[model samples]
Target: MHRRRSVVLTALTALVAIYSLVPLFWLVVNATKTQQGLLSSFGLWFGDGKFALLDNIRQTLTYDDGVFVRWLGNTLLYVVAGAGGATLLATLGGYGLAKFDFPGKRAVFAVVIGAVAVPGTALAVPTFLMFSRMGLTNTPWSVIIPSLVSPFGLYLMWTFAAQAVPDEMLEAARIDGAGEFRTFFRVSAPLLGPGIVTVLLFTVVATWNNYFLPLIMLKDPRWYPLTIGLNSWNDQAQTVGGQAVFNLVITGSLLTILPLLAAFLLLQRYWQSGLAAGSVKE
Candidate 1:
C-alpha cells in the first residue's frame, strides 16, 4: 500500500512539472519563429526553415533605439533597490519582533498580520493617491518606495528568527560586551543566513516580476520596467501604425526569464537549506 502511494505521488508530481514547463517550452519554441511564422506555426514546435532565433534576439535588444536596454536597466535598479531594501527591513524588523520585548509589541504584530492578509492590489489605488500627493508619482521612487515593504518577508523572517535564533546565544553575546547592533551583526545575523537568503530570493522575484504597480505609477516610457515594457510591445502588435514586433515580444519574454532562472538555479541550494533549517527547531 505504501509503495502504491509513492508511485501515485510521483506520477502526480511529474504531471505538475510538465504542466509548469509546457508553457515555457512553447515560449522558447515560438521565440525562434518570425511574426508570420508564429501566427501560422504549431505553438509547440519549430516552423519549417524558419529558425530566426538570433535575429529575433538582436531585434529585441536593439529595437526602438534600444529602449529595451533602458527598460532592463530600470528593472535591475528597481529589483536591487526594492528587494534589497525589503530584505533589510524584514530581517531587522523580524529579528526585533522575535528577540526584543518592547511596549506595543503585540499591537505591532497584529498590524503586521493584518498587513499580510491585505492584498497588494487592494492598496494600489490608495498608494497611487498617496504617492501622487507627495509628488512622487511618475518617478522611480513611486515603485521603489512601495516595493521596500514586504509583509510576507517580515512574517517569514519573524517565524524563522524565532526558531533559528536562541535567547541563550543572544545573552552570551551581551555578556561579551557586544552592543545590541553588534550582537545582531556578529551573532544572530550569521545564524539567520538561511532565512535571510530565503527572504532575499522571494523579494528579488517579486520586484523583478512586478508590473501593475509600476504601470500605474510610471507615465514616462523611460521609467518602465521589463514587465511593462514587454507588455507595451504586445500592445503595439495589436495597434495600427505600431510596429508589429510579435517575434521581439516573444524573444524578449524569453530573455526576461533567463536572469530569474539563473538566479534560482544558482541559489537553489541555499534556498533549500534555509527553508529546511527554518522548518525544524534546532
Candidate 2:
C-alpha cells in the first residue's frame, strides 16, 4: 500500500510540474520568433527559418529609446526597497510578537491573520485614494509604501521565530549584558537567517511581479515597471500606427523572469534549510 501511494504521489508531482512548466516552455519558444512568425508558427516549437532570439532581445532592450531598461530599473528599485523593507519589518514584528509580551497581543495577531485573509486587490482602490489624498499618487512611493506591508510574511516569520528562537538563548544574552537590539542583531539575526531569506524571497517575487498596484498608482510611462510596460506593448500592438513588437514583448517577459529564476536557484539552499528546520522542533 505504501509503495502504491508513493507511485501515485510521484505521478501527481510530475503532472503538476508539467502543468506549471508548459507555459514557460511556450514563452521561451515564442520569444525566439518574430511577430509574424509568432502568429503563424506553432507555439511550442521554433518557426522555420525565423529564429530571431538575439534580434528579439536586442529590439526588446533597445525599443522606445530604451524604455525597457528604465522599466527594468524601476522594477529592481521597487523590489529592493519594497521587499527589503517588508522583510525587515516582518522579521522584527514577528520576532517581537513571538518573544515579547505586550497588551493586546492576541488582538494584534488576530488582526494580522485577518489581513492575510483579505486579498490585496480588494484594498487597491482604497489605498490609492489614501495615497492620493497625501499627494503620493503617480509616484514611486505609491507602489513602495503598499508593498512594504506583508501580512503573510509576518505570519510566516512569527511561526518560524516561535519555533527557531529559543528562550534560553535570549535569556542568556540578556544575562550577559546584551541589550535587546544588540541581542537581536548579534545573535537572533544570525539564527533567523533562513526565515529571513524565505521572507525576502517571497516579498521580492511579490514586488517584482506586482502590476495592479502600479497600474493604478502610476500613470507616467517613466515610472512604469516591467509588468505594466510589457502590457502597454501588448496594447500598443493592437492599435493602428503602433509598433507590433510582440516579439519584443515575449523576449522582455523571458528576460523579466530570469532574475526571479536565478534568485530561486541561488537561494534554494537557504529556503530548503529554513523549511526543514521549521518542520522539526528541538
Candidate 3:
C-alpha cells in the first residue's frame, strides 16, 4: 500500500511539471516560424515543415533601424549599474545596521523596516515629481538612481549579515592593527559572500523587470529597455491589422529572457552555497 501511494504521488508531480512547462515548450516551437508560418502553424508544434528562423532573426534586427539591440544595451546598462550599486549599498548598510551601535540606531532601523513595507510603485509619482523639479526626467539616471534604494535587499542583507558575520572575528582583526574599513573589506566582506550574491541577484532581476519607472521617465524610444520595447510591439499588435510582428515579438521575448537565465545559472551555485553556509554556523 505504501509503495502504491508513492507511485501515485510521483505521477501527480510529473503531471504538474509538464503542465507548468507547456507554455515555454509552445513558445520555443513558435519562435522558429516566420510570421506566415506562425499564423498557420499549430500552436503546440511546427507547421507543414519548417520556417526560416534566421530570416525572422534578420528581420527582427533590421526592423525599426535595429532598435532592439539598443534596447538590449540599455537594459544591460540599467541592470549592471543599478544592481551593482544596490548590492554595494545593501552590503555596507546591512553590515553597519547589524554590527554597529550608533546614535538613533533604533530609529534608523525602524525607518528601514518601514521602508521594506513600502512598495516601489507607490513611490513612483513622488519620484517623478522630485525628478521633474530637478529636471532629471527622461534620463537613465531617473531609473538607475531609484533602483539603488532597495529596502527589501537591505533587509535581507541585514538579516544575513547578523547571522553570517561574527563580531568576534571583527574584534580579532582590529587587535591585529587592521582599520575598520580594512577589516570590513579584507575580513568581514569575504564572509558575507553568499548573502551578497543573493542580494545582487534579487536587485538585478528587480531592475531588469522594472516597467512603470521607465515608462514614466523615458520619453524617447532610443532609451527604452526590452520591457518597454516589447510592450511597444505588443501595443502595435493590438492596434495593427496583421500579425506580421507576432513571430518577432515572440523571438524578442525569448532573447530577452536568455541573460536572466544565464545570470541564474551562473549564480545559483553561489546562492545554494550561501544558504547552506548560513544554515551551518560555527
Candidate 4:
C-alpha cells in the first residue's frame, strides 16, 4: 500500500512539473519560428522553415531603436532599487521584531499580520489615487515605492529570525559590548544569510514580474519594464496598421525569463543551506 501511494505521489508530482513546463516548452518552440511560421505551424512543434531564433532575437533587440533593451534596463533598475530596498527593509524590520521588545510590539505584530493578509491588488487603486494626489503617478517612483513594502517578505524573515537567531547568542554579543548595530552586523547577520537570500529571491521575483503596477503607473514607453514592453509588442497585432512582431515578442519573452531562471538556479544553494543551518548540535 505504501509503495502504491509513493508511486501515485510521484506520478502526481511529475504531472505538476509537466504542467508548469508546458508553456515554457511552447514558448521555446514558438520563439524559434519566423513570423510566417508562427501563424502557420503548430506551436508545440518546430516549423518546416529555418530556425529564425537568432533573427527574432536580433530584431527584438533592434526593434523600435532598441526599446526592448531600454525596457530591460528599466526592469534592472526597478529590481535593484525597489526589490533591493524591499529586502533591506524587510530584513531590518524582521530582525528588529524578532529580537527586540518595545512599546506597541503586539500592535505592530498585529499590523504586520494584517498587512500580510491584504493582497497587493486590493491596495492598487487606493495606492494609485494616493500617488496621483502626490503627483507620483506616471513615474518610476510609483512602482519602486510600492514594491518596497513586502509584507510577506517581512513576515517570513521575522519567523526565520526567531528560529535562526538564538537568545543566548544575542546575550553573549551584548556581554561582548557589541552595540545593537554591531551585534546585528557581526553575529545575527551571518546566521541570517539563508533568510536574507530567500527574501531577496522573493523581492527580486516580485519586482521582476510586476506588471499591473507599472502598467498603471508608467505611461512613458522608455520607462516600461519587460512585462509591459513585451505585452505592448504582442498587442500590436490588434491595432489597425500596426506591425505584427509576434516572433520578436516570443523571443523577448524568452529573454525576459532567462535572468529569473538564472537567479533561481544560483540562489538555490542558500535554500539548501537553510535546511542544514540549525540541524547541528555543538
Please give, for residues 55-88, the per-residue lDDT of candidate 1 as tens digits. 9999999999999999999999999999999999
Which whole-number lDDT from 0 to 100 does residue 181 have in model 2? 99
Candidate 3, residue 216: lDDT: 92
TM per candidate comes to 0.95, 0.95, 0.91, 0.97
Error of 4 at 100 (Å): 0.5
Query: What ranges in model 3 sit over 4 Å off?
Result: 1-20, 276-282
Decoy 2 TM-score against native? 0.95
The models' CA-based lDDT, in order, is: 0.92, 0.93, 0.88, 0.92
The window of 10 residues in a row where model 3 has the poorest summed lDDT is 237-246
Candidate 1 segments whose C-alpha is farther than 4 A from its true place: 241-243, 273-282
The candidate scoring highest on TM-score is: 4
lDDT of 2: 0.93
- The positional error of residue 268 in candidate 2, measured at the CA in angstroms, is 0.8
Judge candidate 4 against the unseen true structure and give its global Cα lDDT, from 0 to 1: 0.92
- What global local distance difference test value does model 1 have? 0.92
Q: lDDT tens string, model 3, 12-113? A: 999999997897788778888877787776589788756777777787777889999999999999998899999999999999999998899889889999
Q: Deviation in angstroms for 122 in model 2?
A: 0.9
